[model samples]
Target: MKSLLLAVCLILALHCGEAAVTCETVAEDLYPCISYVAQGGSVPDTCCTGIRTLNSQAQTTEDRQSICRCIKSAMGGAPLDSINNALSLPAKCGVNLPFNPSPSTNCDSIN
Candidate 1:
């Protein structure tokens, strides 16, 4: 479970942008996710699916930022803020999320 959280965090950080992604970023994202889980909430399936797609598609800053935003939004408003606060990620990570993020969809499907 801990490792899964770590992976999720690392994936989120990496989705922030290649330059911004780091172990610290991973740690940052992890804190809030764990907190949310500890509060008896599960990480939304949409969030996980977003992260996975982001990890698979990440190649540029724009792509990363888009993915970050998608994941944050999937978590809904509060979790989004918590993720940003814990990760110290740029506000861009909060921008332009897709309306739908079904597991079968790709980043291109977001727009």
Candidate 2:
């Protein structure tokens, strides 16, 4: 029936509208902050800009979880100093991240 077809099309459209955040996108957004995350130093303007952009893009719970997982993966086995610095990045950059940055953080609980 036409009604059934319409419902299927609507479902597909709604699902398609949900953009899944990818690690590649996360990496590109965080690329500018690598130096700050690597070592305790002054945060760059570019880094803050990137953070703001990433924060704005992560408007959904799923997106936030994805970003958190990508960040943890990117910092795998990193030194505590580096992780600590990474944790300070959001504050330093003046960006309020939905999830805390840490290797031990549970991405699923971010929402």
Candidate 3:
């Protein structure tokens, strides 16, 4: 859970660009998705809801990159097992996430 929070924060922080979105908001918006990524099952409604909210919040290149960084930071890097699940999450959740969740993804280039 902590890792997830960190990842969300870092990702949002990196993607936030000049907006300065907080790690706390990112953490709140992304916490639900972590379980799906870890366990590989149907994504919970809460998770999707959170993701949708995140999508709405991350409306800029910097915000998207910040989110990506937060996610990677949470993982301490992309955990091999959860990476695929993380990557597919946006499409499955019905949101067009602007950045990839992989640790290697360059948040600055997200736009």
TM-score top scorer: 2
**Which pairs clash in the backbone of model 1?**
none
User: Ranking by TM-score, best first?
Assistant: 2, 3, 1
* Highest lDDT against the true fold, candidate: 3
Question: Against the hidden reference, what TM-scores do the models get?
Answer: 0.33, 0.78, 0.75
Write model 2 residue lDDT over 1-111, tens digit each, in one string.
Answer: 344334323433333223476666666666677677666679888888888888998888888887777777666666788778778888887778877868889988988
Off by over 4 Å in 1: 17-31, 34-65, 68-98
**lDDT, candidates in the order shown:** 0.43, 0.70, 0.72
Which lDDT tens digits does candidate 3 get at residues 10-105? 665554334555556777777788788877889989988988987888877777776666666666555677878877888998888766777677
Higher-scoring candidate on lDDT, 2 or 3? 3
> Residue 95 lDDT in model 2?
79
How high a TM-score does candidate 3 get?
0.75
- Model 3: how far residue 10 lies from native, Å: 10
Q: Could you tell me which 10 consecutive residues in candidate 2 have the lowest summed lDDT? A: 8-17
Candidate ordering by lDDT (highest first): 3, 2, 1
| Residue 53 lDDT in candidate 3 | 86
What is the RMSD, in Å, between candidate 2 and the native fold over all Cα?
13.3
